[model samples]
Target chain A: MSDRSLSELGEQGLLPLLQAFCPAEQRGDDAAILTPPAGQQLVVSSDVLVEGIHFSEATTPPAAIGWRAAAANLSDLAAMGATPAGITLALALPSDRRLSWLQQIYQGLDRCLKQYDCPLIGGDLSRSPTATLAVTALGWVNPNRVIRRSTAQVGDWIMATGTHGLSRLGLGHLLGEWTLAEPLRDQAIAAHQAPKPRLDVVPLLARSQPAGTVWRVAGMDSSDGLADAVLQICRASQVGAVIEALPLPATTSFDRDRLIQAALYGGEDFELVLCLSPDWAQALLELLGEQAQVIGQITEKPVVQLRLSDRTEILSLDRGFQHFTTH
Target chain B: MSDRSLSELGEQGLLPLLQAFCPAEQRGDDAAILTPPAGQQLVVSSDVLVEGIHFSEATTPPAAIGWRAAAANLSDLAAMGATPAGITLALALPSDRRLSWLQQIYQGLDRCLKQYDCPLIGGDLSRSPTATLAVTALGWVNPNRVIRRSTAQVGDWIMATGTHGLSRLGLGHLLGEWTLAEPLRDQAIAAHQAPKPRLDVVPLLARSQPAGTVWRVAGMDSSDGLADAVLQICRASQVGAVIEALPLPATTSFDRDRLIQAALYGGEDFELVLCLSPDWAQALLELLGEQAQVIGQITEKPVVQLRLSDRTEILSLDRGFQHFTTH
Candidate 1:
């Protein structure tokens, strides 16, 4: 084994190693000035995905690893209603990993980014004992349609794009919270590995007219599930919410309480939490019929409650996700 | 000790980690989007400073750790002659470090950012086995004068901001390079620890207009030494360079060969490497007289050579930072 120091590994190991894939077009420039076909706003965000943390050593497939990495950043862009443009990957790998795994990650990122028309522009490569990835993605957004996390208001209706509890179910399967059979296991694993970030309704949501611009429900990506997203929307927009029991789209075969909890705190469901004025909700669903549905409504009160019955509202047992603390 | 897993970091950590000190007005938004104060265009760049390798675990103090982290990003802004604005710190700390030390890094960053009038805007923190800091600083540029790294042309003069070989020299001293006298050791330690990022030249250089636009001379921050930066400049701008043996500015007692080598490739100098028109050389110095000076000029051969004497020209070594290949 080489007794090379970290700084030496950092300086020497990373810079030259980066030449293997990092394009020479951006050698010494300050930042890769990504010019989208002009008239496009830049959608930018950063995420840190860690090993044995974001994924376990044995369970994380190389392709999945690569896909999820791009997925997380794309989700951020989708949260902003931005069209995926380009990405830069900063990876910290152990010295001993097979080069084939690295190639797989590249391939995975290439595939997803290509789907979004976002190219991997530039990145930094270095060695650390732990496997880590910090990805910064840039996307294009039209000014009128960019969504903010602070737009949801009291009296507005709440909505989630798709099923909520499945990803948590998927995670439950990953962390061994429950055992899943093959087709079942594959489905859960797929949910865990390749979350489809919603980018389809951005233009519609962005151009949703006066009510959409004024009292349109604000949004945040549901990495921590719809209920937790409820809390986040509540906190950011300064409004509480009452999610309807019958309307929530969730995973089948999930326990009621666990399903509620998963909807509240189970992570990585890349759905949008839209809080629209009750009057506008009907028109929105009519316009966005198949793409969205009203799942709840905003309340003036600060407590995030669930309405199982008119007089029997149940408060969430978990207010937020603490993946490290409880799980 | 709590056995919190990485996911427990949740969206934010469970334990109410000390909140970031971003201005209240800038916090809680989808992202911190700043409108440049009248007459300023935002300057932006990012950098990653890793741990266990950048500094010896022994001598890198908390304040220096924080200071260097901010300085690394600030240096990039300075090279572009941009006025610092705000920064986001993405920190991944080793699980073993004390919260108190983590706080001290904040202390160091606060001092540096405050000095540059750059406030902490926002950041993300996570857990890992080794510390790593990814810093992205926002700055203001004079729209007409944003410098780039690919503009250095043939016959342009090459200039650097400060002396070289000091950061690693200080590192060497801390790693027991020699039994240093107190004052000497202190200076070396300070250089290694809180290396100055020259932000004092942005307006001066803009006023100087050394070239058509301040952007005319391609430039970048010198993390590695002067020669290494020169090679990067040569490679990016597609040119070559020559240096007079006696014109290098270094400390009186510095070792000539080591000084040259470090100047060539001792990373993290955090200075500006500029390639400008020869006529702009004297004007550049007049503008940045006490701040930066004229170091050398650009050439056409696409090689870095040193002129030792009338009949002695030698091809310089391009081997200071070779990081990737190890057997």
Candidate 2:
């Protein structure tokens, strides 16, 4: 027969399997004890993923659901230039969910945490009407090197890591909205199913700054589309942005206009949008090579503008993906 | 007309309302930056509350739901003998939920956090089929004074803070399983709807030991039944327990047997069950006075026995509450 349902297994019966993913010493405690890195500030963030809203069981595998949840929180930490410390996951599962599905979710979460050199520290589990995953990630960063979204200055160059629109295209394909041929189709699906956080660029940014000088860079993860992220940074910093170009994935199969729309408003890209001094941006570009690209510049005018070859138009602030509202 | 729904307000529009409870400087960041206390280990725990399973709108008010969620996580920190640092709340609400209802929840959360001297740090908001709240609490504890459930020794006395079964009786009253009278009914309902974590006992336990001496106490919160908490400590410590008495509230409205059953098996008490050396137990008893009582002792027999005046019985291991299973 198949594995027992969660109701049959019970929460107590499920502890051993969950404990396998966490360190034994940290397991079996009311709260896990963590020692923060010496001389570093702790950075904490949380994100929630709901079935049908954030994802669908029809399109997202159980493991991918777990992976996406962890990645989302980790992306926030990466935006703050923090090194991961640990993760606390509170999961609400339907009583009828299979034990194998939960095990797969934990495996995916463990895979991501292992890659980031962090442990599944502590969490809670309960029965719910729908599957929900809330992940709280703890990380550490040097106080001097920590990044913020409110410090962008006029004349700073706007840059982004990785291409956009792939995840959106992947979701379209998953929903049967369109079809794509090999390689690109697989790439798009993988991008949607398992988005990677821009943690690798954090170290590169740290090294790009001089030893004694303070680092001042404004950054945010483009989880809610590239244009939305840039607009947010611009609003927070009391500055404006002129997007001269859109970062598109290297694919000729999709139309340019459609790809541009996806790039501007696709969401869930998990890439970093950064604003920094021109010299520092150049140094980071040199260090990151082709992994990063400059697409815009911070302006004195307090408005976001998309300046294409034919015309320039102001972007609406409300165009970003939002919960409870249809795209 | 009624206030706007979450779907109408959207996630961006909801930020300012959620930001009201957190510090302005810490708000609007991808992740909040926190400095750990000087020379202390961080204790982290998370808890989730789901509608219809953990609570019902028919019985629990919106503010109470928020209060209970924060209290549940705070109780876990208290079990580790830690001082509150901060709380991060991830909430998934039905899109149709009113803005006023969410405001009340935040108000209750703010009240709890203010009482504990912690701030609402960071979190995420999402849309779900049912209301779900996940709270992650961070606390700090002195390394030498940290408490663990696996440290119970065979000759230690088992004690608990506050009377048991009040919350259970309150829940019963709320569910209409039994009707309670006037003051008792109100008390029970309050206890059920807004349980308080025994954070005050943490300082008392810390001071119970002499200067420069390490703490050797095993502890856990009786969020699960008192008997279950005792059993967990025993199982982790590889010891047995003998319950010579049961802690009952000061009331004559209920029969002794029913009260005993409730005290032994009723969950959601939010009280502390602790095992310590006899001298330390006596010291804590003196410090706590009427707020605490001794009910049992650690044994080497590897079984839990309830020794009553008329008869003795061995308690079943599976009698405690387990999620995803019917009580």
Candidate 3:
């Protein structure tokens, strides 16, 4: 376990190898016995954002990389109505990369943590030939206000914070097919890069604490295409959804076809999905004000259909970035 | 965001890309809500055992790969006096490998989990050019008995559970130096392949739950070499130690010079370093008996020194396998 070079030793060698060198206190324990401040439950989640699978070679920036890592995890806590706490980044990259890029990456992470008010507690850094990053964000949840996707019921009006598809536009720009002006381009790019996690809105949602029984948050982040996200919600809640196409927050840069596609498929929106009943919608709106808009309704039909203004036309898309799917 | 492919998306895209796809419930909530029933305060630890790094190319078997992944993480839980619960694996592998090999890898993992009585909960699987496996094992720590390294006091007796250096012996066998019988060779190999995480012993120690004052099993695990581990403990507790080398388990497979190196530096002993008052040693033995042995006493000098039974031996060794020295 301890003798040979890594290439000669392989995975099995780690136990004995580590046993020889690692401190007994840190070594024997399952997890480090963190001396957290009095009364803090460990917050945790694991995310693997793959390269060539999730992003492209052309456009992602180092800071954006850093910001989004925290944002995705932070968003999860938000949906659960939990406060952002500590984070761990388990990153895998090629061994040959320069240290500057890594420092810049951390810089981006620092920016996000400061913005979200989350602390960078721990992380694991490793090298791989291909770039891959897995981060597990830990946060503490208030015992009462924990939001879950399973709590949403059939009658709740579905709502979302922020616009969809701007990230896709940024991606388009990266792909060279689209030309965008400065502010709009920056906005679109920011939607993809340095996307904000709604830590601010979670506590507010908790105060109103809209019907935890039926009218609740479900599914999660819009990183997948909107249609795919709706499908996930349906799968998790075991109900169908009828999303009104016109009500979706639209962007000016897209044509009708592209706009609808982005609404349906363009993702990385980092929006909140709130499902509430008719009477509670007003209460929720008052609590939330203009943070979001009513976009759809939950259904039992087990189908995700896009409803048109005509009421007769429905749109359906077959493909979006399913993690299991091969391109 | 969309359509740019993975490479163009780059490193800093973790947040947006992850936010884009992961379902809200699973993505970034404060902590993953494992809703069965929170009986024990959850103990969590993650180890990213990398390839061409932690292990060797020659000795790494699929079964060993699988086995060590579970064993390494479970050992930490055991160190905490925690019962192994659910385990999650995030695996990144090189493509173009056999499906059978992958299946065998799981077979090894399944063996450890089943034997240790922990269930496989959830996981993330993907491909990487370099083989990397990260395992997070969750266990339950007794609220009152959660042992920590910093809690070790000034006069604590340092002891180790089980013998050390067997893993190095097995590595020697694999390298064709250990001319042993098949059973002994297998034993060494198994030591490397599947570390016996002392779960049963941990709970027993917790139940015994010695004095309110003595060091409560501080500075656990044998990741780095024993001396390095001792150094870490001293640094954490802000003290020093004189290790009795005779009681420190030595092996026969290595030659005189090699034996000393292996015994002192060979990692992965998976032994517990208990910090107990000398008064409690007898009671601990009444409970743990001969499986435990007093090896040293904590000192105030803030320096770690080794004592040899023969001739107050002078040593010529400090450089050890530090996992990565290349960078």
Candidate 4:
């Protein structure tokens, strides 16, 4: 196919190309027609990824940019323990960009959409000085089984799903600050580009406990780093936390301090940091296998204390990424 | 209060302020949980407006910026004949913009959300090189009653709800290309900044017809100019149109040619253009009072022809504001 500017494709010409990427169930005119199955509540969340802020063109390909944006929003639904249904993307691109670039981006987007079984329903396109993508992913969950960040109790065990700090490691490799050979470097880069949401575990997590028992699991996606996410749960639930001195999952080969720093302060990991009742911890661990790890425990005191591996120091760390403060 | 940057407010610091503006029904963790009432299908649409593309910072205020973005998306729901349920805003702004300015934007957003009974459910905020807003509005409609752009039939009366060229006139006034005194200028400017979505008319339009009767009504919001909207409907329906030189609702005080050109070519009007059955047209006209007018009719041939007022000339025009082209 010949290269064409998005302006050349125009809005009218672009619709078919976009629609081709969508599943047949959601190709409506103005809005997608969705019927949430009976006994389910619709769950909706939105996230925007700007060109310079979220991904720099110098280090990222267009397709990966799209995949990363989709992953971020899908992860929000994953945190709620909801099944992904559909997503709408609103994109702004500089007119100078070729339509081929958009197609490649959509290819990445389609990879995630297909993996999650979420269709692209509708979107709007506009001109911008820099490329920006805003995506809204909709999902469904039983009304009674929804998870919230504010429900972690003082005695709950903190568990993280999937490897933490991998994305940050990938960034290091991309920037040439560090180097890893073959498969390891590729794994790091893939982790950064297409971090999968733990949608498979949501159903298991949302499964009801015994009839009279109080439900135990509460969590959110660790997009803002593990430390920040734990702090958020504490702030919302009016509790505190104590991070155990255990080695983090998937950090054996890396420098200890750097990986720990990335696990604590680096953002965009897209893993779930969950608080579960101590009784259910073993069951969750068995269910998640090597993907889950017990990182810490909730505390009664209103402070976050990290228990050092050296066995003597219990230091209070407040170094998680905060949007306004760091910028 | 001191002037605080968005970074200063931070995502966490701004949540309470943002929550203060949202309706009570939709404040939740992770994603808003919405239960669509029985028998209604959930409808969703998203639109993004970027700085310098949709509106420049020089002439438009921050509040208007927020309001316009919401209006545009809400209008999409209106076109779908959906009752507004909720909206999620994804915002990206330079760190230097004041929190107060952001607050004002929310104020404008609040105005529309409250007016339509659509709550602000959730949002994401991040730093960007340019100020940009992307809004996703959700609504509901009877599954069988969705009015699609492709459903327009030949011999349908092409009806337009509300004024056509007012927003373009407003733009001219903003650029100081023309002068209007007092309320006329203000009215034009309001049309540009806060083009109200026809939420009130959607229910009336979606009213089901008698059993076994063919319901001949199809519509879409006219955002990309009237001419462009007509072309979209024609292309989708594989039909033709004949626009009559009838007097538009708000063009009495303007020069004929300029107003006509604006009506046909300028965009961001947010008005609904419907193809109605001849019998239903009169009833809709009566119901809508001064806000509705029959501008043309859908034709058998696949061409858009404009009939001149003097009855001596017929013209085919394809001028409309398209992205990437004019920019």
Candidate 5:
């Protein structure tokens, strides 16, 4: 309840508060026990968010930081077409960080987990100069239904869930690099801070497939922007892609060129970029309504080419977010 | 191989190098897929190590850092009587760190994983001011045989795997707090730098149990020191304990009092403290030979007492290593 620093609380004092976030029976054990669902394989992924690299305390709230960190791993599961099982957090915080701040972070993490039916099973805590959160998420999927990024066929259509650029624009607004009207500005900020993972779309994707027919769907989350996601899929699948259009969100404040760049190179979108056969794509589009759109198509050229109205250009892989490099 | 910084290699350039540490088929996917062994429940744990807090770059090498970080999580799995399935790493390093350093770290991590037959399945990388490693380990155990810390019955004999105080002494030598002779000094240093998890003793404990007999053994790793481990088991099981002796290693350099203090309060031993019936304890001692020893016995009184030839004293839980507090 008090805004005491972690140094004051100590590891012994902080553990009980953390235990409250996990199931009572699973707490006080060396490790949490889990049983995989019958007829399902386990899906696991880990993601790290550093204080300065992933989020800034100046612009991001503690709760949003927790929500965004958890969302990143959940998005990975969604990309694999897996249902959320549980997540473990290994957190390192500065000794001077307030106990209230940590509680809020856990609250936000709990909200996101509850939304996706993922439980906080276990975690480890430590002290550091810079706060760091490494989250490992677990999910389950039928062996036959698991999607991958390396199986895109030459004729498959590239589809994406939700429009891009909104998250980037939100970041721009937060950094004072751009401006937008009331509702749009708020929407952009929310998208940048708490981007939702597309786990809801996973079941819908299964429904889009024709009953009794086998289809291969290759997909990944667009956390590093649409351009990088498409490039990765192309490289892995040994196929190329022709981008007919960018999935830009409706925003009048930015020019077409800027919007295109934001949609292409801006990072942390958390949308799903998927490739499937034309029949499946059409069925998915009808079922998803306006929630999804066809942005491109796969080709055999082994290069990502943007086929705009008046010009064609190859999208470079080096342009998106790279950990240590200046963008 | 060049000693260029990670900024020079970039994320795309670094992927292949990091990928080499993981299984070839599991690399480049949204999430790694795993099938738990038939009829076994999955056990999961996470552990984080931070520079300055857990280790210093001046005294610790990159590979040892990686190995120790992995060992910490593996130790948790061992405490749960689980056989490791796989491990995932989420590492954050400063951009200025050389590629060779990261590679060596991975080499150390690979060595530890290979030793335990635990494959590296997945990981995430990021840039940060301070170096940090968060490892999540997965293992499998039978539901009926899972060891818990809260199951110690009254009158159970307390036992420990391996000699204590060596790791703490090794840490002291590393920090220039103490001096020792040739073989012992090297042994102490190695213990501090690369403490092995007592996973090998898990099956031996099972062998010690009589065939077709159900045993409720309570156990946990003594990473936080033997005294703290005993206190935790006592609190969790609502039982007390009497420490009859300190499982001190052979050393003439320190007096009995100093050795006892080191064994009780010095941390990061990675040994197991267990409570079982006297019959099982005797069988385990015969099977383990010099690898394990009986140290105490569980009591009905709700307190931990240390008994010696001179007098008896109550052990304090606050004496052990705690994060955010100076020892």
Candidate 6:
């Protein structure tokens, strides 16, 4: 028993070890008691990352896995224009030596938590044949400031925050299929490993919600892919979209078509695709500078049309990350 | 694509089908907005149930699986005496036809949620090699009304709500090693499949805490078995306890030793182990009647003594449902 594994700790012995990692205020009792601030709606969302399905042990380090898992859930909060308050994690791991792996993962979580001011409320640790991470992040926002995927109005500009296609290129680098020079490789790898959630953009979008602002924001994270996300926004909002061939956001050695393909179909980008009025779009771009890029426009028809530099075409929009379905 | 599997529905296609089951107030947005009522502290907890590890297709049905999964988290809320508000589930499954399986699970969740007024708020669906269900339940409690597992005091009466050992006996029947007749078998199976959380007891305990009352309640659910749960409370509260060989509840044909073992070590009872002043124990007993039973007394020493009719022994307290550790 003295030399027992985490399995031996059996949640009992494991609690003390893990409790040190959680914020002090969130420890004890079966559940944490949160004093949600007045006038703010508590926004909650959960995301799970299963090993082999979401990441490869061969390529992704433990810390990156932890960082990415937390980031994925945080991205959900960002999509809603919510400021993260806390997160509860449910971790399933394989072995005791994985304790070190978990510690690294906690380091990753701590970095994200500290940067975003979200505390690690509490979590459950269990053993599994394969590793899985589930994160439920709680955030706060004015009820009127909530952004939804189902409210993109006709004639609204479709905009994306930050760049797209970097994570795809990063995946390529991880797979040893593409070679990039110097900082580009590091940047690409970072994008894939620890993509930043657009928490900073929430306040800017929130600013547009006071009294009688003309801007209406409808959005979600572009995790599956750009085209698929556009299709989802259109389907949810009961509108269509016309996506122009936007310039590729990452420095890549791939040809134009490959870069375009990555931008349209490469998943794990973690960028926000938003719909807003054109005037607000201009105002947002001026505020966010180059971080906000207008990529398309919402239309009344329920179709997704991709306009290339030299050709106009409608895409089937069938390729995005769907669980159980193999690409 | 029309004939595509859940993997093809990817999270996007599957959302609408599952969305219909969740409350309309909790749908649409990336994150659900919850307005925590004034003067109440938000209480939240999460639990995970993995297939094969926690249940098997040979023994448990999908609805039971769903029911048990939600029940497990709700039990945590019940342990804290919190009234459930909403729940967010993250489900990982294997196939497309399992949509029916999922619907059954949702039916189970709906049954529990409806009974407690806890709405199905939001969730994430993903594909997995094996099925996994993670539920995060949110509730609310008066800040002063919160109970803890670590506050048991010396000379306090150790009590239990509801019966013991039925779930374990039911598990035995489920494994085909045992059999029960008629209503008892059904009751035992229900105990295993959908053991009720003691939400009804919270108000009773809260009723005791109105200024200068001698009663102080310290409690937690006995999901891990009586001995293990006792040991846990004893350790956290830094007190010992003397558990009597109490009369077993539920009609069973098992011999005395077997019945005694089941009562002492059977896990998943979902009953609560509480500590309170002796006088309040009588008050609570009068209030709850047979639902509340005095099983032991907290002692000053740091040891657990189990007293039989003619013999007394120290308990090793090794048995419990521990994750990762094999039975």
lDDT of 3 at A316: 40
User: Sort by DockQ, best first: what order?
Assistant: 5, 2, 4, 6, 1, 3
Mark the 10 consecutive residues where model 1 chain B has the least summed lDDT: B309-318
lDDT of 2 by residue, B1-327 (tens): 569999888888888888888898789789898999789899999988999988888788889888888888899999999988888999999999999999989988888777878888988899998899999999999898888999998999999998899888888888877888877788778888888899999999877875555679798999988888888899899999999977888888876777777788888889999998888999899999999999899999889999989669888658878888987
Share of native interface contacts recovered by each model? 0.19, 0.88, 0.21, 0.83, 0.89, 0.69
Which pairs clash (backbone N, Cα, C closer than 3 Å) in model 4? A324-B7
Tell me model 6's lDDT, rounded to 2 decimals: 0.80
Question: Tens-digit lDDT track for model 4 on A236-257?
Answer: 7889989884435453567878
TM-score of chain B of each: 0.85, 0.97, 0.81, 0.93, 0.97, 0.94
lDDT of each candidate versus the true structure? 0.68, 0.89, 0.63, 0.80, 0.90, 0.80
Ranking by TM-score: 5, 2, 4, 6, 1, 3
Estimate, for each residue in A191-212, the C-alpha lDDT of model 5 and write its tens digit.
9988999998899888999776
For DockQ, the strongest prediction is 5
Expressed as tens digits, the lDDT of each residue in A106-126 for candidate 2 is 988888878878889988889
Question: In angstroms, how far off is B29's CA in candidate 3?
Answer: 10
RMSD of each: 4.6, 1.4, 7.4, 2.4, 1.2, 2.7
lDDT of 4 at B115: 79
Q: Which residue segments of model 2 deviate by more than 4 Å?
A: B211-213
Structure candidate 2, residue pairs in collision: none
The true-versus-predicted C-alpha distance at residue A321 of model 6, in Å, is 1.5
Residues B119-226, candidate 5, lDDT per residue (tens digit)? 999989999999999899999988888889999989899999998988888877788887778778988888888889988988887889977679688999999899
Q: What is the DockQ for all candidates, taken in turn?
A: 0.33, 0.86, 0.21, 0.74, 0.89, 0.64
